[model samples]
Target chain A: GAGVSQSPSNKVTEKGKDVELRCDPISGHTALYWYRQSLGQGLEFLIYFQGNSAPDKSGLPSDRFSAERTGGSVSTLTIQRTQQEDSAVYLCASSLARWDTEAFFGQGTRLTVV
Target chain B: AQRVTQPEKLLSVFKGAPVELKCNYSYSGSPELFWYVQYSRQRLQLLLRHISRESIKGFTADLNKGETSFHLKKPFAQEEDSAMYYCALSKAAGNKLTFGGGTRVLVKP
Candidate 1:
């Protein structure tokens, strides 16, 4: 892909419903990151995947938030029992690799929990 | 724990005026600093990185290790420069980044 691509650019889900967000990072890029952007807020780190290394999930806000990267290419973020507070933009980014490299960001998924 | 701070939430400048957006970071090890911008209706994109030390769209940032600041600067502000700017930092050899609160710049013509 020319850049990072996220699916369901906009999503509206009812409270308690589960939602899945997808990200396809730039081909051959080895590092992927997930972030959450709330209204008028800074980007909040969610998770990161580097090649086949164990993912860094320290930033996940709660047990309901989980993510996984398959084959080191595509990734999915699953939110279970979503809450109104979960409404925000979910962004994905990828870089050639970690360490001193530039990252390309996707359009982002705006998830609205109604 | 790495952290980035952008004190000003909004900055307004007249066209042709010099502009500076402040950013500070706190990290124990050597850090990689970057500025990302989000234009109206556009996706967030990287404006510049400290390691590259290259200016983009007339914007440049200097990373000062002593002050732990990476401030973005431009000699002349343009209306097109109006956008939300975020400063971020990552520890050397790490992938995760901590981002600042972001500053919205408005250039009046």
Candidate 2:
């Protein structure tokens, strides 16, 4: 793909239900980032993946929020027992290198937890 | 911990008027600052970085280490420039970026 791709574009789930958001980063990009944005709020860093391993997981809101990347390409953010506060736009971005580069972002997944 | 702060939630400017979007940060080490913008129905994209010192689409931001500010500025605002702007800070070589609350700019005709 020419740019980062994310799916499903929008999801509406009941509270306590689990949800999964997927992100496919740009080809050959080694750095992937996951961020959560509340309504009219700044992005909250969730995790950062350097290839298949995540060097930073300190930003995850809780233990129920976990993410994984496979083959250093596709990444999935999973939230177990979702809460109303979990409703937000989940954005994914990829960069060629860790530094001195711009990150390309996906359209983002709008998650609605009822 | 590094943090970015954007004070304005909304700003309106007439076309051709000067515009400034404020940003501040807190970091102990040297920080790299960036501005990202998102237009209506579009994905977030990079506007400019402090290190590059390059102006894009008539917008520029200067890093002020003394005040820990990196406000985005434009001499003449355009309707096309209406968008959501975010300020971000990163470590000298860090992969993760700390983003500030975005400011929604509306350039009226």
- Indicate which candidate wins on lDDT: 1
Whole-model Cα lDDT per candidate? 0.92, 0.92
- lDDT by residue (B6-107, candidate 1, tens digit) is 999999999999999999999878988999999988989989999898999999999898998999999999999999999988776666777899999999
Every model's DockQ, to 2 decimals? Answer: 0.76, 0.68
Q: After superposition, how far is residue B1 of candidate 1 from its true place, in Å?
A: 1.6
TM-score of chain A of each: 0.98, 0.96
Model 1, A1-114: lDDT tens digits are 788999999999999999999999999998999999999887888999989889999999999999999998999999999999999999999987767777889999999999
lDDT of 2 by residue, B1-109 (tens): 8888898999999999999999999998888889999999999999999889999999999998999999999999999999999998878666578899899999999
DockQ result, candidate 2: 0.68
Using alpha carbons, what is the TM-score of model 1? 0.96
Model 2 residue runs over 4 Å out of place are: A52-54
Query: Which pairs of residues collide in model 2?
Result: none
Q: Is the docking of candidate 1 incorrect, acceptable, medium or high quality?
A: medium
